[model samples]
Target: MTDTSCIEIPEESSSEKVQQIDLLYKCISKLKEADRVLITLVLDEKPYEQIAEITGITENNLRVKIHRIKKELTEIFHKYARL
Candidate 1:
């Protein structure tokens, strides 16, 4: 977090707000579906075994994917911050 920056969203109606949220989902839709799945499970604080069972993936693979997703998110933020 930095005091030198801030986020400002233009005032929008409720419907517009939903549209804005959908727009973000749409961007992720273009990304690998696996990453989306990883995000969903990780956000819920699910254990690796649970995520694996839900996704039918091996636990080790799930760990690798989660790590990759963290890196991906970091890059996504960096990409936006530079803009």
Candidate 2:
């Protein structure tokens, strides 16, 4: 979603990694439960079809939703990055 293939998880200092993890949790916590679950499954590398079946959504619709969710995550992550 949102071409996340371009995003590289940088090797960071331990403290920086912890801060990034904290920021990620904060961002994810703001999502609705369904969105949270979807994102989590995506993060876990679950297949789209499987995720769709579990969430009772069509694959196309789930793709769109995941794109939007990733966009939101990018925005939230940037907010924390700025700080």
Candidate 3:
């Protein structure tokens, strides 16, 4: 016998989600075109191998680039969020 239970997931209000998404897009827009493309692919949940192939960069370089891009995006997001 197995007991089944439903776990409740907290949901953000649609308006709040929309605002956050708008802020994220604004942050992404501030990035260079190449960075924007790479981040977009990453956000789309593309695998690292496919991203590397698509961007013509090695996996190691891709990882480093992603780290930098995320750091930059976070800064940008925080800057705008503070306003």
Q: Pick the candidate with the highest lDDT.
A: 3
Candidate 1's residue-wise lDDT over 1-83, tens digit each? Answer: 56745767668789978875665565455558879977777877998899899999899988888888777766664565465
Candidate 1 vs 3: which has more lDDT: 3
Best by TM-score: 3
- For model 2, what is the error of residue 16's alpha carbon versus the real structure, in angstroms, after optimal superposition? 0.9
lDDT of 3 by residue, 52-78 (tens): 999999999999999999999999999
Q: Against the true structure, what is each candidate's TM-score?
A: 0.61, 0.79, 0.86
- How does model 2 score by TM-score? 0.79
Q: Cα deviation of 29 in candidate 2 (Å)? A: 0.4
The C-alpha stretches of model 3 lying farther than 4 A from their native spots are 1-10
* Descending-TM-score candidate ranking: 3, 2, 1
Which scores higher on lDDT, 1 or 2? 2
Instruction: Give the whole-model CA lDDT for all candidates, comma-separated.
Output: 0.75, 0.93, 0.98
The order by descending lDDT is 3, 2, 1
Ten contiguous residues minimizing lDDT sum, candidate 2: 1-10
